[model samples]
Target: MPTLVKRLLAALVIFLLLVVINQYMSKEGLFGFGVPSYYARLIVLAGINIILAVSLNLITGFTGQFSIGHAGFMAVGAYSSAYLTVYYAQAWERSLGGIVGGSLAHALIFLLAILVGAIVAALAGLIVGIPSLRLRGDYLAIVTLGFAEIIRIVILNIDSVGGATGFTVPGYANFLWVYAFAIITIVIVYNIVHSDAGRALVSIREDELAAEAMGINTTRYKVLAFVISSALAGMAGVLAGHYLSFLSTNDFQFIRSFEIIIMIVLGGMGSLTGAILGAIIITFLPELLRTLGPRLESLLSSIFGADNIPASVHTFLLQLANYRLVIFAALLILIMLTRPQGILGTREFGLSWLKRARRRPEGDKPVGTGGVSIAEQEPPSAIDRAKEVKNQ
Candidate 1:
């Protein structure tokens, strides 16, 4: 099939999926099938985290670079976007007047603000990537980590945007908006990974020295990957700011970056599917654990008889919420010990899945030399044919 045709088909499929997803998000339910609002919010967060993971995977997995400042880029995006929508929105709204108004105007403003923020964050990435690209290994990681701290400090001191008090952003993003951006990020990253440029990136990852010797511009590609990755992280931040309706430098702390890293690493670096799966798990795992305490308390009560349960034991069970991180960390450790390459490694779940499907005609059967029905026969293969010839 033509590339354009295939792309159109993919776009159509994506549009349909988004429609269904949006329908399911409606409060009254879509044809009696809908997720609760809280769960819907969780789903939106998963999509945002997925973007962060896939974007980081581009740099760390495909390009063989280590960056621990994803949250910094995210902060830049959120703050810039919030500053525009929250503070300067009326000015833009007035300027638009009859050109567009109401919800339409809001949507346009939201997208424009996000774009501006993404550009600003991309510029930041360029600044950091250029100076830091010369270094490698721990040196590079240190530089990126330091960059994150600097961003946090700078944002913290900006009193106009609330300083340490944080800023309240306008919540203009719905699940559909989140899903749209998520799809855009996925499509863009997937194409980059599969394109000629993507091949150059993989080459750099495999052996930078070899790729450089083969006439590839290693520094340029490294910086390109870094900037793109950072920009995507910024997009995620924009979505987050709009969805959560608030922003704080603390929210984009180094630990947040670490969580994104954990998602990609645990899902399997270099695999898009892994990054997505990892994002979903990391986002929902805490929510799942919140209920674990209550469930455990009830189960233990039933098992040992409620009257016999000690107050100390019950208190300890109630305190399980504080230990969720410990449990989450243990899960990561166990996963690492079992599958060091990550959940899916570098494998993909793309078109090859469809190519591998089989459709045999009904009532199809094999016949022996005597023209009698053969209930079972060896599957067709070159090796099987050779074995039959050898037997004859």
Candidate 2:
């Protein structure tokens, strides 16, 4: 089968799976049980994180730039979008009596906010990239890290935007908005990565001097990639802010940036499918761990006997809730030690193993056996026959 056809089929299958899952979630319940709202929130978070990871991969992974301030761009987007939505929504409500006054009007407002977020974030990327892209390695990382801290502090001091108390955004996010934007982000990044521009970015990653010698205009491509990545991060922030209906300076701190970096590293830095997988796994893992706390406590109690189990054991388990960051750091370190290439390495899931598995013919010979036809076989030469006779 043609590669295009195979890719289309795989995409169709993924789409179907997503549809089925969404339908199931929309129904009465799961296994005769009602799923909590927090699970849905987790799914939304996973989607947003996927966007962040995949977008950052374009810059840090494919383009070979070190960026540690992604959350700063996200902050720009969140604040910009929140400001537009809150102030405009209020103005529109006062003039037209609510978002329902006209669907078109409501949509226009929403689109305006999204565009503002993207533009603001892209500008922030440009500002940071102009000077920082001149540096490399640890220098660039430090510059970006400092930039993120500056953004946090600036937001903290901006009183009109809610200052230290934070701002309350209107709840306007749903599954539709979150997943639609996520899909858009993925599609845009995917197309860009496969384009000629993407080849230029990859060239820079391979060797900056070599790319420059080849007249590839490395700096231009680097800035472009950074801007695009930052814009997507901003969009993700907008989605998260709207969904949660709250925004705080603390929410976009450096720790959030580190979390995103960890996801990209753990997922295989250059692979989009890996980014999505990493995002989902990391997002749900903590929730899954939380669920196990009670079971672990009970198991320990049984093993040690209730009398032997100290009250501090329960207290310690409760403290595990506060130790999530430590666990995340430990997991990252373990992954780095055991599999530095990441869960999927630098290859995409759809590009290698999955594609091979799906496309292999049922009865085909093994790939490297060299199954020559009898007609192509040749008898031994006269020299060989003479040598055999001499040996005998």
Best-performing candidate as measured by lDDT: 1
Predicted candidate 1 versus true structure: per-residue lDDT over 1-392, tens digit per residue: 99999999988898888878888886877989899999998998998998899999999989999999999999998888888887898678777866876667777888898898789889999999999987888899999999998998999999877789989888888778888888888889999999999999999999989999999999999999999998998988999998898888889889998999999899999999999999999999988887788898899888998888889988988999899889988988999999999999998766775676676655653456444455454456999789999999
Candidate 2 achieves a global lDDT of 0.84
Which pairs of residues collide in model 2?
Answer: none
Using TM-score, give the best candidate's number: 1
Candidates in order, TM-scores: namely: 0.85, 0.80
The alpha-carbon lDDT assigned to residue 111 of candidate 2 equals 70
Candidate 2 lDDT score at position 134: 82
